[model samples]
Target: MPSAPTVIQHPPRREGLGPPIAAGVVTALVGFTSSFAVVLAGLQSVGATQSQAASGLLALTLTFGAAILWLSWRSKMPVTLAWSTPGAALLASAGMVDGGWPAAVGAFLLVGVLILLTGLLPVLGRLMGRIPTALAQAMLAGVLLPLCLAPFKSLGTAPLLVGPVALCWLLLLKLAPRWAVPGALVVALAVIGIHLGVNGTYLPADALVPRLEWTTPAFSVEAAVGLALPLFIVTMASQNIPGVAVLKSFGFTTPWRSSMVMTGAGTMAGAVFGGHAINLAALSAALAAGEEAGRNPGQRWRAAFVSGLAYLVLAVFSAALVTVVAAAPPGLLEAVAGLALLGTLAAAISSALAEAEERVPACITFLLAASGLSFGGIGAAFWALTCGILVRWLLKPGPLVRKARGSGPRAPRQ
Candidate 1:
């Protein structure tokens, strides 16, 4: 018989320049294409000037990127951070009512404080632990599903550009999942080039320039109830919780509460700098946690630090970068994001329903989560858990003791 392949274990090494650079690029692109676009749109919808929105984006990118790098290095873990996309959506739905930008700042500050408090309070963390895992997974998947679907819809609007990209994605997914995203992006760019060759559409050459202007925070009960609480729920239920799960899936068991504490502290720091919600980034974690990050878990933080430095650079030139990124064809962004997320999506679903008994609860959570239900300023995640728990309780049968008593213990035949 052939000998079994030898398993070689060696100390982790610091990844070379190439992997860190690649990871940084992936992190930056995902941040730009995701809520960074939506946040700009939301702010614009609320009557904020373009400059203000651009400033906010700059603030978010720098704060989150720097925080991730710092914390990941300290913890010796590849802890990637990102803005809470669901929180941004909640902001969009609430619109820019009486307080406008000031309220947003105020809400961000308040939520950050609350998150910090959560970290300090062990009782709260214990309570969160009591919540069933299936429910938590369901809520997270529900929150992220909308984002995953967006890239596919772009094909309808720009078939000539998006179709080729989608095909490329499928091929890569089938043949080589690891390089699918960058590969799809290359194919999309090629398609764009061919179209431009025939129709002669001009692309922008201007760079994004960053400008900073601080808006004083205004606090009100309405803002607290309407914006702050929702932001907290989304950040906690939709971001931090799932982010920890992602790390666990990869077999890393860093202190969960400590990570939360850092994330909360980071959110507060971002608030002071005029950014929106910030939390751990499950997506970016994949970049640093990949085999390329380093064989040794201890060294993966380098990639995150590189990403952080890149974020700082981008923050310095926010306006120019935003314009340049915005000019990219939508298909290029969507196909790349979708291909990148497929693996994560599969892993999440598998973990969400690992137990057969938990499947029903998981299903309930998934449906409620996917429903995008909101009420009285609270977003879908909180409500989905509530509904899922209720269903689980209602469906549970009566205690076996009660059943035995009712049947008179098999008529004492024994």
Candidate 2:
């Protein structure tokens, strides 16, 4: 027989960086625009003044932006980082600690320390893993419940302002779920602008410029347990661990030790300027790692690197964005924030109630979190986790954890 013709496999054509660049831009915009209001709301709830909250937003944007740049560049793994949206929701529910804004800042610092410890100690990471997924998710859902109700609550009071935003959210949610919150936010900004124009309120002269304000940290036992511990747990369970899973699903491995250290250190530094927390990006990581960035996985890190660059650019507008959001008619921005979190709330609920046997404990946890119950100056989030775990153990008296890889549960998509 004639020798078969030799065949050579050819590599994919280079798309000239356009695809990755575009995906990077989308990732940054979606990541930043989607949950920034929650960050502002969370900071304000924990005793930050509007200017301080603005500073917090600025700090978070800048720190995470820098972290992503360094992580992607060093690892070339499309590693991205984000402010912890669930952590922010937890803060929004926790309210002001006994130590006030300084206390909240201290809690943020402690959360960083915990993240660092988790990276350095395998035991600690496993301890975190041992928290039953149902309880952990239930705790997150509970933390989110009150905030998620804002849009509907606003409908009863400020329908004229909130209705349009809600409508925009609904339309996009059905048509393009990814853009739903951002679309709603745009509608809210328009409403704010119209209301401002009619009422003759102009944005502050300095509001357009970004400012970083520093606060001295004060550690309190209450803040530590109430804010810091829960913040760390939520960030780890809901962001970092899932971020690893996300990258893995796309055939990549996260540099867990290095990323934890970087994000931990970055969170500590940002806390001084009033940020809450930062962690590996979860939902948004897909944008960079997916085929949309390019068919070749090796080059996808460019998408993330470019996203980090875009975030740095967005950081410049953080203060201005906060100012505009703050200027909105009451409840308008809350509606937007609520809309932003709806998907998260749904995911949390689903996960928390996934196992038939775990339903009762999860329900109790959810109710406590939603009730915003506080005792001994500790917020409900901590207590909810405690109670849920206790209930599960008391009721079943055995390992209740859902089977998964060596990590906590994957969080709901942001």
Candidate 3:
């Protein structure tokens, strides 16, 4: 008999809770401040009432909070979860459908089912994996372009308030990159407080009470093909795929199927309360799984648990949270969001342009996606990818021609 293969395991290591606690807090703050306003706007664009929007926020936080806690504990990894920010952006751009919020909720449910199916079927996962990374990144970049421009555009309107926040962000980025966004958030809050003191009673006092609202789903063919399909594609391509990549970069073995099932379940739970979608977090995951989270890799899961606890607390105050976000100055919230996403935008652009042969198609995808075009009720993101793939196929040398020329099989680009 052949000798048994040697088994290797990482040594167990644990540390004091201080680092993990800090990491958890940072993760929570970054996750919430970075995109909560966009989420609220997305909900309202689809005709959600103020109460419904608050409930959506609450539902998203609670569902993902529970997921982060359970997945982290069970997997012994820092598996942070977040609402699908790109999906929210897509909703914001798409506006209302014929059936209004009910139709949007139906689309969300359909997306959840699709995500669940992808998890249960290996073939679906493999198909998603085969989507070109350059095109996907280009599409995401296009989706983000308009929102990322908000900071500079706000300079003319709220120069005094926006200036200091931008300045603080830059200073913090240079001095302490990890705390840059939080520092910018602190500045925004300070400005808001001063404005409130001068302007008087911006936010309602009773916005603190937790409220839940439900909308019965009403499916539409337009929404199913337009919103549901695009939401599913972006959530998987831009969020879940990169989320897994983040974990792999940190040396964690991803349990992809289980994560998808859990996220899909969370999305479905959120849909009943008017939330759009929830998925694995990419940026926040890095903060929780990085070296800064803990001295011992084995204990980083504690950070995710703490982050989940913070999310739970936020959920309890969801009504107040939405009110405060609503009270912010026009364009100010977007400025803050834009600043927070600059790094993500940079990374996406770089990734999209890295492959020389794919550059033209990627650029086409980016331009079309950024155009915010809609056709037959479908969003530009879907069309952008389709066009890019078509362009790539057209530009490639034909197999028969290559064989006639005595060239061997061409190697695929990464």
Residues 1-93, candidate 1: write the lDDT tens digits: 999999999886645677766776666665544345555544543345666777777778877877877777787777778877656655544
State in Å the error of residue 108, model 2: 0.3
For each candidate in the order shown, give its overall lDDT on alpha carbons.
0.67, 0.91, 0.85
> What's model 3's overall lDDT?
0.85
What ranking emerges by lDDT with the best candidate at the front?
A: 2, 3, 1
Work out the TM-score per prediction: 0.70, 0.93, 0.89
lDDT tens per residue, model 2, 4-94: 9999999956678898999899999999999999998899999999889988888898998998889899998899999999999999999
Candidate 2: pairs in clash: none
Q: Compare candidates 1 and 2 on lDDT and give the better one.
A: 2
Query: Over all chains combined, what TM-score does candidate 1 have?
Result: 0.70
Residue-by-residue lDDT tens digits, candidate 3, 345-411: 7887899999998999999999988898888867677788889889988877798877787966889
* Best-matching candidate per lDDT: 2
Clashes of 2: 0
Q: How much does candidate 3 score in TM-score?
A: 0.89
